[model samples]
Target: MSKDQVLDPGAIAARLADLPAWKEADGWIVRTYRTHSWKGTLMVINTVGHLAEAAWHHPDLTASYAWVEVRLTTHSAKGLTEKDFALARKIEEVVGWQPGLEGGALEGTPSDPRFAYIKHGR
Candidate 1:
């Protein structure tokens, strides 16, 4: 979808909330993750890289020794949209981190595969 189409906040919020701990501010969706170390963080970044490339949508990423922050917005749209929500969901799925949960799902494990269902959902 073209990024020019703005999304309704109410509808977008409903979808984003289910994507773990993403927050909305200044018309951007933000999520921060803490990794074990620089190596782990890079791994996460690399994984996200492939996902974003495949989706043909990109996020604003900031990474350090142990943390990675992602801010996503449809720049062309000047706001949120189904594309943004969909990307956020994919990211949350791949990273295996959920905001309130005691722990994140196991990455690289065969079970709880979110990507496996993405194509079918579409």
Candidate 2:
């Protein structure tokens, strides 16, 4: 299909299987990330902002002291599209990364409650 083509319900449902944290609602694919604090919420927002800007495919965000909801759809296509799924995957990856679990040089944020940030989904 073309880049801007709108995905039908079946296609959207199939695509959502790869994004368990997200769901189809209205005309958008949406996900909500819960954070440990206001700081974590801001971090999630900023991280999403950077990704959206870089991809040039922005998403609508709803944030609070401990949560952030991301809603994505292709405005030009007037519905969900590959761009929405692609960006959602990238956002999920970066937001959910835990370097500590990966045994990498970059140890992720400390487990200490004082330093904990996102309340990563299981």
Candidate 3:
């Protein structure tokens, strides 16, 4: 995916089909990861940063104590693009991580508050 190419609605929809956990919102593809604790939140942010850095396509991150929202778009392209989807896919791979397990379950305690900010499975 070229960083310079902006994806049209059809193309965006096609890409989004493969990324069910993400949605196109306010001109960006976004996903919010819920974590069990403050530590989990930081872990997610750090992991996202690492992936963004490695891919050279960054996402806008908003993180609180137990969740981090990642929004991806090609800033230079001024719209959604393949690069955004590529990065989003990579992020999904790492974000759905469970230690010593292959995407077993989300990492979080069941006792955490079920607020909007606190996503399920943390």
- lDDT leader: 2
User: lDDT (0-100) at residue 49 of candidate 2?
Assistant: 100
The TM-score values for the models, in the order shown, are 0.73, 0.97, 0.79
lDDT of 2 by residue, 1-122 (tens): 88789999999999999999998999999999999999999999999999999999999999999999999999998999999999999999999998989995999998799998999764
User: Which residue ranges in model 3 land beyond 4 Å of their true spot?
Assistant: 1-3, 103-122
Sort every candidate by TM-score, greatest first. 2, 3, 1
Write down the lDDT of every candidate, Cα atoms only: 0.72, 0.94, 0.80
Pairs in steric clash, model 3: 34-122, 35-122
- Better structure of 1 and 2 per TM-score: 2
lDDT of 1 at 44: 73
Ranking by lDDT: 2, 3, 1
Q: Which pairs of residues clash in candidate 2, taking residues 3 or more apart in a chain or in different chains? A: none
> Model 2, residue 101: displacement in angstroms?
0.8
Best by TM-score: 2
Q: Candidate 2 — which residues are off by over 4 angstroms?
A: none
